[model samples]
Target: MEDEAPVIYGLEFQARALAAQAGETDQIRFIVGTQSLRQENQVHHIDFDDENNVINKNVFMHREGEMWHISASTVDKSLLTTCYNKTSESKAEMRAALWRLPGDFDDVQSEDQSSHQSLSLVCHLDATDYGDMKSVMWHPTGDNSNVVGLADNHIVVWDIDTSGNSAQMTSSAGLESKGQPKLTCSSWDPHHNCVQIATANDTFIRGWDLRTMQQTYVIENAHGQLVRDVDFNPNKQYYIVSCGDDCKVKFWDIRNVGEPLKVLSDHSHWVWSVRYNRFHDQLVLSSSSDSRVILNNIVSLSSEPYGNLIENDEDDDDDADDRESREASPPQDGVIATYEEHEDSVYTVDWSTADPWVFASLSYDGRLVINRVPRAEKYKILL
Candidate 1:
């Protein structure tokens, strides 16, 4: 008997291993990073494009005046990308700039669309005092021109109004209580008119109503271990899903706080990310620490999952219903699709709003997949 090569996408792929027997067979070799902390540890951190002059480690888009501005997150210094028309062809190339600031943000008002048609630098923000920003998000309204960020677990909401001087209006939350760590993930509720945001930590998930400045809802012990990601359905306010180091993807109805509406336990390792397809409420996609992506049908929890079936009211002489009840139904199997492309752990996965079938995945081994979502074509497109 002879050894065979590994396969990918139904085709055999071969690679040479560092250690091989004298005349036996070849093996696959794995490469280690030269700039690694420990030779065996995988270091996966965010990296900016070296070709671009901007030095900020993170980037986001914000609206100012009548155009849109792309900004960077930097500590002690302030740099911004040039402005571009909100709906024009030249919006793609506006590169970001970096500098110092006087306060939280720069007052750059929206411009008049008819007269000020060109995309250029309208103004700059004073981000020096903002301090180590862990994450940033643009105002979803597209008119208020506010930018929100999380720093040391404190939320900073920036109002980009010009009457306020170089620095603009700022609001802070979650700062009263000290000794709080930065919330790892902050997600805006797309279903609530985009006026609410939710944050996740080791033991809890907190929802904040941006317009009311109130803590809307809190899920205690969202996971026994750290909750890696939290997401809300685009049209369902009563529902949310969470995944974590516990290796479980839980679906919650918010109505019940004691337990999840359903607990999916199929992943062999910790779940890194879980996403609901906005186009279809019944389809959920998840990426895990097992180096695989799983697609699941969300309707398995429903009372009448397969829809109404014709029922015969007449009693049968053979007692068929009694006999059928004695046979136990099989346990639920979670996975609908399993993708095993990445050689390392998959960290994140997101579905495109413009194209639901198209999704993206980022992995610890520096692999990015931007193709049709697995089994997306088989499911109904609800969007």
Candidate 2:
């Protein structure tokens, strides 16, 4: 396969949030929300077509408020969640809610193209009157019925009844200390069948076991500064990756958080996000305020470094060639690429659900750049 140029798309408004659409493999789709308090905010649906090397888009109006975050639902292809800024009693407040797309979204387009359809309302998530809603995370598994909302000093799990278009809080835990330290970020534990969650509170990484609504583990000072994002290793049971303002991306085996399994100081500024490839845990991505996206191939720490190997008892020659090919590719344990396509701070980077080699990054300036792994690197392991 030949290497191709990275595809770039710009939005009309500035943005900081993006999420790859889930449960679909036909098209490379991403959902982005705009942040503009002065004008009407919008939700952008971007589709990247690899065969033609082009992008297709659809825009929907979000009349509620300025958007801060967006999350696509895995169980329902048409449903999504957002955390938005709104004016409540002459004060700015953030809230979370579920919105759905029209059934004919794929085929529907206006004649003028200027008039856009508004997102259908699914439900409004319940939150404290004063706490600022940071993000609404869907379950780690395919089930979207249960969602956890992280806000100032609190983490709440909600039971969403999409059929009735309503949400009810099931359980919640508040951080109590000398000063109520606000929660920063969190990820649902996929290893525990989504019964536990790992949250970043300031510099601390705390694991919450939802079965008993109790704290299971706490990693004090996971980072020197505020933790920005945490993601679970999809293939590994207890492994997680975290990044923070310290400009370090640390991988941990949640069972023992005393020391990180590996630490990478690749970004010069604050590391805003760290993600593990859903299929290949060794492939990691980190975005930062330095306006760069770093892709790392972490081999030894991954569950499988050389892909699945089947020992052959009959063909000695075939096995030897296989071994040589694996050796030649040698697991690259360090940074592979630093993408500086965006001039503004990159808050999020996500791998495409449709294509493993393809991923996208969103900057604060509303620029979306979709890029792929170098073909030479992609063929190293395959050949």
- lDDT per residue, candidate 1, 1-383, as tens digits? 22111122110111110000111112111111111122221111112122331211111222221111122321111322222212334542211122222222112212222331222233443333544444455443344556666654666676654333343536777733335645666666766567888877666787888876678777888888888777776656667888989998998876676788888887888898888876665568788879887877765543224332223346645467664653334223356666777676777666544455545455555554443544433433221
TM-score of 1: 0.58
Model number with the top lDDT:
2
lDDT by candidate, in order shown: 0.50, 0.86
- Top TM-score prediction, candidate number: 2
Model 2 residue runs over 4 Å out of place are 109-112, 307-329
Clashes of each: 12, 0
What CA root-mean-square deviation does each model show from the true structure?
15.6, 2.2
TM-score of each: 0.58, 0.94
